[model samples]
Target: MVAGRSGNTQLVAALDRKASALGLYVGQPLANARAMVPALRVVAEDAPADAKLLARIADWCDRYTPFVALDPPRGLLLDVSGVGHLFDGEQALLDRIRAELRRQGFAVRGAMASTALAARALARHRDGCVVAPGDESKAVAPLPIEALDLDEPATHAFRRAGLKTIGQAAGRKRAELTARFGSRLVYMIDTALARANAPISPRRPLPDYRAERNFAEPVATEDIIRQTLLALAGALSELLEKRGEGARRLEAVFFRADGIVRRIAVEAGAPLREPNAMVRLFHEKLAALADPLDPGFGFDLIRLCADRIGRAEAEAQQLDSDAGRERELRLLVDRLAARFGRDRILAFHPCDTNIPEHAFALLPAQHAGPAERPWKKLRGAKEAPRRPLRLFARPERLGLLRAVDGRYHMRWRNTQRLLTRIEGPERIAMEWWRSAEPTRDYYRVEDENGRRFWLCRDAQSGQWSVQGGFA
Candidate 1:
């Protein structure tokens, strides 16, 4: 028996079958139970341990269905809508889940119904029950009002009003229930009767595509693990191809026999559909883990899931072609991103700004979406590029002079430069709302050495500096 503090006295939080049969029940005062049976064994209740154990069981249940939701204290809600046929039927699937959980040393009670409330009520009163569609109200009508899990006072009020069964309470008008028991109670009833829907909040997001392999005997061999991933990737690829989609992010979930789960994820800059390419990314990710994926006591299940999917259609291509080259570069980026951290590998995103330095920002390539603004080509086709290929981190001061014939001369980096020509002073204004920064003018100048430079002049201070250089 597990005892925990309840009010001023200790009460039994839980009990074993033997303790239950000995006339000791949960919520019974521990002192009273000890008085009833002097030799009764007792242990302290561990709420945290219980919660962690439930979480682990939920993770293990991912093998059965991705739509697994926690039902708190000791319940798990699984939405196995289209997957029942895989295990034969609803009854068979229910039996299998319970049997496997029992094998893992858990005493589980489960029921299926059209609604979660109905299922909860049935699981508590009618274990192993599978209510057919639209029969939830009829099925639960005979159970007591306590079946709804009402608080003690509410249950007492219903009993005082001579409503002994669920059918009796549900027969009352909605208005009366609201006036006395409140809307929450009415909602509970409505959901239990399948007249309303209560969506379960799943613990994890549903994957776009999924494939798995379950081994009868646990296997820890790296070769087998690798082969399993390859096969699952192939299966997933087939599914993705049928829908003209590919995975932007893929996760491999390893389920160890001992209820330990390890999930390793890899992301691609572009949609990835090739099985070989997907496997290679996982290889790099697994190899680069600071703490290696430990197959403690071997893994019984291996699942590959495409968490984030993107459009990918078959196209004619050549290895030397531009499209093929782009694909190769994207694949290379994915590999590099997996080896290093995604954040550590960055790409430039164009920002919608006129300031040269603020025009682009570095973001993680794998996660960065389309740029807010596209790169603008400053010069027209067949014309010299307006922006410099290389911009200095900070502008360098320069001495400038104009000759009588309108030619220019400049001294930069302590070297005198005889300019052949100088472009007009293209004016650029500073952001007025932000600061008191002065407006500036820019010029493109070429020296006698056939080198070009982008120079800027301070509008108010009359200071000149070389801002950047052209390649």
Candidate 2:
């Protein structure tokens, strides 16, 4: 029983066979119910708790199929299109679902039809309902107009016009009904009778590949579980190799005997296909979990799925020893990343831009391939390192003056420094599309102490600053 408007206690929201037999209906006043039955027990309604339990029940249904949706207030929809054959047939599958949910202390009602709306209506309104493919309109005719979920005004209008059952509404002119009440009513009836299309939305992403093992008796030993995972990985790897593709992310789901499910996931730094390598990565991932996986009461089923996939080209044995060495080095890096973490290992990638500060960026080592375009060099110049070995994040200002002899003199940090020789005025203008900073004229200068320094003069401000240093 729950509270109604004006703080008055209302009728029961739900009741069993005995209460119904005693002439008690849902939404009936609680005071009237107690008067009808002197000795009665009642509990407060908890909408949130009921919704949470329903969600968990929907999750448990994933062992059957990944496409499970909730029909709020109390209903669940499972689109078992291709999965029905796995459990023998549609009737047998429905029976299994009902039996399992009933065993878990739920009063479950199930029905199957060609359309979701028809199946839902049958499950709610009829017992043991299974509508044949072509018999939808006949089967739905007996149900009331309220089954279409029309608004209160429309339902009252239908009742006032002597339309009580679906048959009465369907017998009327389709054009008149659509014109009077809009297309929603017509669409609802069409959907309910399998005339219109209704699609199911899955709660989880469909995996690229999935493999499952169902044990006659639950098994919980760690060694056996690990072996099972390795076997599944081997099979999946073989499948991937045949398609010339590899998995970038994999997930393992352990469905326990007591209706509890646990999932462990691992991400690959690169496209991976080797059976042994995949197993090793999962081992490392499982070991690194903050909370160790517990196979409480054993697991009745285990499934391995490839969540993300990518193309993997089969490489021929390299003839050059250097190429072979590079391959080995990459393999080592992949192994290290698998054991520690992906972000812990990184490499610099050249960015396609003219600005010196935006020339390169750090990316994951596994994905750090050469840029689309190589860095442009000076025209007719030999390959040489022009940029300084160490560039400061920001240039430091220097108090310097150009002498009459075209030489530079500066006193930095209270120490006198003289430029004995200079190399260039490699002018680099600021990328106006990116920033409004002034242009700079860069020069490679050697001080009297033989230390090579990179200096720049801001063209707009005429200010000098030290940018970098050479070895």
Candidate 3:
């Protein structure tokens, strides 16, 4: 689950507080943390688990505010602009959030400021809610320059030259600081102090249109459901047309009186505004739902939202116009995807690699369309020799008999093929430091049917396998 080598090691190093304390004295590399304290233990980090945890927290925070941004490696940013009044006050809200996080076993620090950078810096360097509005400069004036998130070497250089506090650095002439530390330092300072606008980029953009319909009574019939969906789609389509755009991703959420919400998403092959088509698409998706649409004391509300959208293009008409046909084909694919599962419908696209097994990737049909890569021009250029047309996701073992003369012959489906053409003894070594190491000698072979295949012999096990086939 670890993303990179450094991140893996850093997580392990962080857990060893004793070693970290000793290494904090003078100049010490992270690798030397174990040397300072011999019993220090380390393990690879799990980035996927971390990301999943952050995502769950983000979802849970929706009760507070819909505006949440993930701060990778740690933390999340919530914009409680107009919504803070509902929770009594800003401090009360922060305390409640902190208490909830504590109950969930998360050690957290909360801060509020006029700007994001100021909030982040204050939270990192000082106590909870370190700086309030209009007090950023006063709060950050005495903090060390390192709180600015400057690079280690730059910080060290600054400290060596006797500029320790942020106030000292801020006191210097703007031009002199810009010339010495480059624009990045100046920008960070200005952003932190609220002189420049610093924006938070959300992991996913907020949905554009949201429409909710409250029913007088629960409706369990398919006809009623379809009717309601059509109405919502019509409203959404009209809203999109006004903006000169069409919906690409749509979500339909049904909320029952019992508070359970069932949501289904549909993605269009192209931006679409047709209400009938959208309703039909959802019908296809809902038909396959395993959970019954139980009224459960009566349904309350049904909401429709557009997650992604794009500009609508003017249609071109021709005698042999395939646009209509293409639309039908895409709709057919969407229905099939909803029924048989999305992974069943796939497309193959070329990858930038000479290795046959790495030369193509399978992409979902819903997301894959005509790409503009110039494959012919790329193939014509001088580069590594082209690979085969077909490659197995993983090689299949082939039984081979070695002759006394140091040659080999293979048998496939009771048919023997002699070692007539052989091209390589290319050897690849294993990465000893990592898990699941492999070492192989690959070769190109031609059979009596004029077919060519790339094969490899495992150096460690002495087993031969067929990896790929040429066009």
Best by lDDT: 1
- For 292-396, candidate 3 gives per-residue lDDT tens digits of 566676556777889888898655533345877787777787777766677888877776544445546788888888754545332456753446667777788
Question: What's the true lDDT of residue 53 in model 3?
Answer: 85
Best by TM-score: 1
Cand. 2 Cα-lDDT: 0.80
**Residue pairs whose backbone atoms clash in candidate 1:** none
Candidate 1 lDDT, 103-133, residue by residue in tens:
9888989899988889998999888888889
Going through the candidates in the order shown, the clash numbers are 0, 1, 1
Model 3 residue pairs with clashes: 1-47
Candidate 1 residue runs with Cα over 4 Å from true position: 5-11, 21-24, 28-44, 352-359, 368-471
Least lDDT summed over 10 consecutive residues: which range in candidate 3? 1-10
- Residue 104 CA error for candidate 1 (Å)? 1.7
Can you write out model 2's per-residue Cα lDDT over 1-471, one digit (the tens) per residue? 342322565658777777778888876788888899877677767778889888888878888987788888788888887887899987888899899989988888888877788788788778466677889888888888877667789999999999999878988999999999998888778888888868877767878887888888999998989889988998898889899999888889888888888887777756778777777777887787778788888998888899899998886668568866776666666666766777878887778776665677778787776566765654356744567778888888888867898788875657768989787788888989888988889888889988888888899998888888877
Quote each prediction's TM-score: 0.77, 0.75, 0.50
- Number of the candidate with higher lDDT, 1 or 2: 1
Q: Among all windows of ten consecutive residues in candidate 1, which has the lowest summed lDDT? A: 352-361
